[model samples]
Target chain A: MSKRNASESTLAHDTWAVEARGLVKQFGDNRAVDGVDLTVRAGTIYGVLGPNGAGKTTTIRMLATLLRPDAGWARIFGYDVVKEPQIVRQLIGVTGQYASVDESLSATENLIIFSRLLGLGRAEAKRKAAELLEEFGLTEAAKRPLKNFSGGMRRRLDLAASLIAQPPLIFLDEPTTGLDPRTRAQMWDTIRRLVKTGSTVLLTTQYLDEADQLADRIAVIDRGRVVAEGTVDELKLSVGTSSLQLRVQSPTDMDRARQMVDQVLGVKSVVSPEAGKITASMANADQVTDLLIRLREARIHLAEMSVQKPSLDEVFLTITVHGVKERESAAVEDEHELEVTRV
Target chain B: MSNVSITPEIRRSLKNHTSLSQSVRNSFTMAYRGLLKIRRTPEQLFDVTFQPIIFTLMFTYIFGGAVSGNVYNYLPIIIPGNLVQTVITTSIVTGVQLREDMDKGVFDRFKSLPIARIAPLAGALLADTVRYTIATVLTFAMGYIMGYRPNGGFGHVVLAGILVIVCSWAVSWIFAFFGVIARTASSVQGISMLILFPLTFLSNAYVPVDTMPKWLQWFVHANPISHLVSAVRDMVNTSAFGGSDLVISLVGAAIIVALFAPLTVRAYMRRT
Candidate 1:
């Protein structure tokens, strides 16, 4: 009972909806989720960005109380997952990587059953089921077995099921992994609506653009570790320099354009002669204007010219790739040290 | 895309969560779901209904003359035997269906809910009582149609049916344990059959124990299925619950449940 009071007081005072510290999960020889930490603020979407096998799902599972962490601890809305899983379960809803609904049951039946399990009365459960069906735009197919529904429909129903109790926090693991572009956009809208209604969300995805579009803060994970975590703009800036790209009017001017841009930017420009294009990284917005002025003075006409901010994709790639290279070099150094000791 | 407002009813439901009574209610809700699955796919009932009928007919006709000179005389022994065999074998469905549900990731959905951990497994076993009842009643009907009337009368015949259903439900806990621990549904089926085939066939269910060799007779007498079949015969034939066999059968079922129910629940908890 004192634990309940503690949780309630913490929930009122703390801005964090979910916090995980030094989480670890080992599956035999592979450290599926190595020591990881997370801090998700209330009423905002926090995204974990990673490629496959990056431990995103494992981390979510631990926070959702489905898997116990081997080392660290997590809390949802001030209730510790390990100590008070029941209270934690009460606070959070989880939509796993796969659609976890029963395919044999109709969509309406699925919703009603989940509502009942969440402590709704029979009539109330039915009413909520109908409302969720309508809300997810599945009212027309409510009576159809879930097996017949499209992938997007199933995913929507899955999300609807998690929302039946209107939990304060929701964990969506790879929510739009296999969805088509239009369906993914629709799901993003649903998520945005959910946030507007005052639900904190922890979303994990392999899509960099998805995190950039949805998350207020993002963490990039690779090989069971977080390599970088920050706002999208900060991550782009951390990777250093936007790119200055220009296309020459004629293919013959591509070499000239590349040389001039190289001299102005003090770096080699990537030249594509067939496309009459040259690209060079620039540290500041003023560099783009300076390059344009220089090109104009040299009488080099351009078909297209623009300074492009580096995409989150490039930031993520650079972070993860550099992390792997660092680890590899560290391993090499360890081996060299071992050789020296042996000698 | 307008924000969906939370109704007051939903807020109330969320606030008052996870009580013991709510767990019981949730268990029944899950059981109702299991029943719905069976209703949509009636083929799942084939083992409990048709298998019992077919096994009774096949065994009685094929071995009746050899064992007892006529099918009518053999009906007394074979009917109870078929009842026990069919009902116990039907318990394997619990584990198989559990494995199928797990494979489909339905149980993972259950894991996130605030309901009791045992609700889904308990509800699934409760819904399976329907299958056991169906097999119990059909085996008797098939027996009566085949000119095998139980002299124990209606009251005692029902007692025997109830006993078989209860015992079969207990045996299901064992298979359910297998289902939770095994890697796949097909493996659960294979492993359960490997254990059940010998228990049912090696007992004195279909034939008198005296006819077997002395060593075989020892095993036949010791077999829990033998005790269950004998208990069933005592109730259905004499209309009297007088024998020690009935006590042994009930105790055996209790022991199976006592041993495997926790094991199954523990394994299921880990997996989910």
Candidate 2:
């Protein structure tokens, strides 16, 4: 028995968990989720973050076996998503972006129905339903119709409903999209616990801070393609090394600070706003002291000087918006270059 | 013992996720859940209950005197015709409900679950059979209360009810395909009625087909609803059974099921 258990544990650990390559979904000429490659290792929260229409939901749906890829192959727990979809389904639970519990049915009954559908026996299904209701903090309202529940409670019920069978992988599509900040944090803790219990999760959300807070690794998708991906630190590094901020007494002092700072840092940019605050970025963290010393030596009176780590929002905007502009201009130049190449 | 218990569970779940069986099981489970929902909310029963009563009374009284010279005489023609029409028309709600469900993102949720791809569509199509049966029973009961007796006896009436329910179920599959493929519930219901109304109304429902003009008469004679109404009329009014009409009705039902089942499944597969 021990030998068999060891073999089973080894088999589970060695698998790539969920792997997809060259995924392309085309609706006519418009590519919705294009040329996406994703690998989510076992027992980690992998987040796909992007703005609306960035194909985050599309990518998650394909991974969950809802949509077939036009030009790629995908496998869940070493089983092909299309060819072995049932196996994939058994291993995973999915909570959609929308609340999907039957509105007329009571929360307890809804959970019981899904439990039975998951192949639990009648008594066992009820037991699982009760367990989930308690776990989701809805035991008091379990018998009430879901139509009467608040939005946050309904979302919790939806998540609980998905987990009745205790699936190994879960796909949560913007699970906390409309929740209050407190509820969102509580939900994040719940997700963290799921990961602790050996469940892998693939989540998609528009909130950059949510990805920064919850994801072990984040994949930033923009305009149907993955523009950047890594741990939070790695992604921040991709944008810049450090953030430099200087607060001046007046607007004139802010400009003087920028002028002195731009020369000292050798950075080509300056952002001294009308509010008498100057915040610029350096190429590296080591340049911050030099920046402050130059400002002090120039006799630029500073109220505040600080060096901070680059934020996820900064990384997101720098990578996504900048990438789009660069692509647009590159396309224009390519068109012109094409004419020149023809000439 | 542990090996015996755990391996099969894992294996069964894995098999359940990938194979076509997942789709079938998913569909059956969803249909079952829908039935449970109907149990919880009985308000949906209004259509099943009220439509049969109103239609039966209105058609039997309003058109009875002019068409057949008396209400009793009208019993033979209109009851059987109404029986066929009401049951078939009740099948339209299946498509409408499907449209509403899709609009509600029920199908969207189903797409992510890794269950059978066809389960949501198939389950919905199956659940409407209960609705079809309810309409069948209520219309027949209304017919009996109105002094329209089925000379074929209780056994034959039961057979006729089953026949209509099964055929309507087959017809609902066509509408179900439209529900999945159409943009809205109203359109699905509209498209289904646009095809059903002319076939039903122009047949032997209210007026005799022989009274119509030549071009119209030719269509009424060839209509599949005409054959079903004839077969039903022969069974209920005169206790007469064996004929080409009965054969034609069965053939029509089989053909509707055969043609639409695959098409609906194909359309449903392409939805995601």
Candidate 3:
């Protein structure tokens, strides 16, 4: 991992599919995107994981050259987004949160119109439209207007429309936000296929499982800032080790179990007497057996026990929640420091 | 999971980006899409086809006897005036439809494409010319059926029709500007109607300027709508060209296009 990081840092700017530095966007008094920086490698899926209003969409908009950043800059394959927006536009395809195809036009008509806009000849445009419709499984509904299309079908057509020019970079903003489980899986397959075709995809999603399943690298953004970024395993490991959870046979034994766990593991345990469960974080998996043996020697009855690695869901929650708390306490500390210095 | 094979021609076109001629071709393609929409939803034609027929008949019968002492005498005045009013009012759809398209995020798709920034707006305005033509022809046909005959020959009538369509197309640019800047489709329609109502009604379209109050006559004579109506009246009624009114109407349309086209494009670029 260290070696990979070193090589990534040494990669030339033109080789990176996307590079954004200190991008900021302000809407009235609200800074929708505040000092965001992103680097995406070619032919890889870079997932931006964040809750709503975390500046993921805003950052994507700026990088796609749809919205101008109030500060800083971005480059796509060494073409500056602001200075050479037309060339950058030629290189990227963007599928926004909303289905952006014309609802009044049929699926075939939508694809053909986009192809024609990309400078395709009439026969070529029609052939390409047919090919894309077949690939997206919309051949049967090609003649039907998009207003009659289901959400999944419309999204597929939207993706098909963006691929008319076969752009090297694609931006998908919450591509599966409202899709059902099956449709989301299909969409994920489509995204994987895009990457297989040598397209670099920058996707922003709020679902932790989505990033874990599809992203080569995930950036956790909270309140317009990246709070954590790494591979899924690295993110989970950053939150600390696996936890040991055990439910005592009797509610009365919960306190004893908690004390025994603290003594054996050298870490504080949280005991819930009502549920009769005691949980403690363990530094290593080998310590799990030691904990059980120590509790047994102390004659603590155990109804259940398990050691589980923290899921990416827990890591995301921990990072976002702790990030908010840290910012708030830091603000308070700054105020106190200001008072002290004034005196 | 594999990439779709691209023809060598397509690959070359993709690398060439967009030239001026390519932008114009793309704009027409967008306009063709707009026309296809109108074809599938034929009810969108009601505003151009039915509105002219209904308004010409209703206004001529209702106000003709009162304004001109007889329906026959009012035919000449009301027909041309109604043509101007109906076609100018038809221009409002350009902005309303544009706003609706923007609300549906269609412009978001266009913004990411390597096409001219003005293509969508230009295409929408171009497609609306068909609507103006329909309104112009229908207004005249309805007038002829109601016993109103223009002494102007076939050539003058065709010229008058072309003039009205061109002026309405120009007026649509202002509404397109409003469409780009307004918050909603309904608001765009509301604001356009608010601006158009006075301009259409206060002109000599329905009632002669002499019948209006002396104070109102000043605005009636000064209204650009009155100039267009007078221009149409001269061409259709007398079969004449080179009238001062025609020059004023043409200049007015040019000024509108020059003033609002850049403003609309600028606002559209910022939002997209």
- If you score just chain A, what TM-score does every candidate get? 0.90, 0.86, 0.88
DockQ of each: 0.43, 0.29, 0.34
TM-score of 2: 0.86
Instruction: Encode model 1's per-residue lDDT on A177-226: one tens digit a residue.
Output: 99999999999999999988888889999888999999999998876788
Total backbone collisions, model 3: 0
- Cα RMSD to the true fold for all candidates: 5.0, 6.1, 6.2
Q: Which window of ten consecutive residues has the lowest lDDT sum in model 2 chain B?
A: B1-10
lDDT per residue, candidate 2, A1-343, as tens digits? 1111234643563446678888888888768888888888877899998877668888878888778889898877766777766566767778889887778789988887777666677898888888888888899999888878988898889888777666778899999988999889888988888777767889998888899998989898876798898998899888777767778765566667777777777765557455556666767667777877877787777777677788888887777666656777664444433432332
Cα lDDT tens digits, model 3, A1-343, are 1111223432456468888888999999778888888888878899999877778999999998899999999988766788778877888889999998999889999999999998899999999999999999999999998889999998999999988888888999999989999999999999998888778899999888999999999988877788888888899999888989899887777777787789878898887666777888998667677878988887888899888888887887788767666667664444433432332
Decide which is better by lDDT, 1 or 3: 3
Residues B91-138 of candidate 2 have per-residue lDDT tens digits of: 888888877877765466566565655677778778878887888888
Write the residue-wise lDDT of candidate 3 on B41-114 in tens digits. Answer: 88989899999999999999999999999999999899999999999999999999888877776678999898
Evaluate residue B88 in candidate 1 and report its C-alpha lDDT on the 0 to 100 scale.
Answer: 94
Best by TM-score: 1
Please give me the DockQ of candidate 2 compared with the native complex: 0.29
Q: Rank the candidates by DockQ, best first.
A: 1, 3, 2
Each candidate's B-chain TM-score, in sequence, is 0.92, 0.88, 0.93
Best by DockQ: 1
Which ranges of candidate 1 are over 4 A from the true structure?
A: A7-13, A250-275, A329-343, B1-20
User: Global CA lDDT of candidate 2, please?
Assistant: 0.78
- What fraction of the true interface contacts does model 2 reproduce? 0.33
> How large is the interface RMSD of each prediction?
4.3, 7.5, 8.9
